[model samples]
Target: MEVLGTIISVIGLIVHIIQKVNQSSHGDTNTTYYTDTTYAVVHKFTPQEKLDNMNIDSLNICYKTAGISGFSIEKARRTLLNSYVQHDFYIDDVIIRQNCMYIKVMHAIPFNGGNKCYGASFSMNFMTVNDGVAVYGSKKINADEELVFKEIANELIKAVS
Candidate 1:
């Protein structure tokens, strides 16, 4: 069983490496924009020490200010909380600062014939940006883990819109 798990993990790593190479070859375009908008992937790790405790260390952040008019910080916070629950993410903790809300979440994925489960922990922040609200997230996940960056960004955009 242990050998099988290792094999699967190795395969997943290979696939991830291939994908990374392909992405880099194509100029590493990780964001999809709409209309005349700009998206930037900011590699800032605010919760590095904390996230490392949960075995998650990859720093992934996205900033988008398109289609956000009349943005309300409080409304975005509430919407993000609701969206997390509705998306089946287990909320670990939340810290509300002056203009930012920090959230920790975990998602469980059933694996190995549904007997074992793989989980990923995510650390994210929703803050008021100059143009609009911004959603920043970080999670260290392998190929078997679901990537939630896009979902978080989309949810935040929806809230601000």
Candidate 2:
């Protein structure tokens, strides 16, 4: 399964590269370096979709905002970013992951195996960079009238209730 996963990742990287090269040949400069479709890709960003590259400390800051900790390895964190999460959703390098940040973070970083705190932070960042919105309201407000998180999580909760 690991070998299969690695193969898929390699293939996805190749496809992204080909797409990039084709776009460049047409005089398009939107060349995005993606490692694989196996990794989550950020579809949007603040101040336009172009990311200026924030430090890994930004992840820690986000974690801190959520009152969490215990993800210290800068190299590992940087590897996570560079290996996956491209462009402005990036720390650097090729993009990485599937839909779940939990699985990826849990596996990617060393010295902190199966840590929910680290995983959740990456998940949140993944969600934020991709869709970056949150919703809040009570039963008192009409569902349609309520401000939504601009993503599926908000609606899923409502549907379940």
Most lDDT-accurate candidate: 1
* Candidate 2 accuracy as TM-score: 0.18
Q: Candidate 2, which segments miss by more than 4 Å at Cα?
A: 29-161
- lDDT of residue 124 for candidate 1: 38
Specify the poorest-scoring 10-residue window by lDDT in model 1: 110-119
Steric clash count of candidate 1 = 0
Compute the lDDT of residue 50 as modeled in candidate 1: 48
The TM-score leader among the candidates is 1
Residue-pair clashes per prediction, in order, are 0, 8
Task: Please give the lDDT score for candidate 1.
Answer: 0.52
In order of appearance, the predictions have TM-scores of: 0.41, 0.18
Candidate 1: tens digits of C-alpha lDDT, residues 1-161: 99999999999999999998988778667666468578787764555454455543343544333545566556766666665443434455554556655556554442223322333333334333444455555543554343444554454455546
Model 1, residue 89: C-alpha shift (Å): 2.3
Which RMSD does model 2 reach against the true structure? 24.3
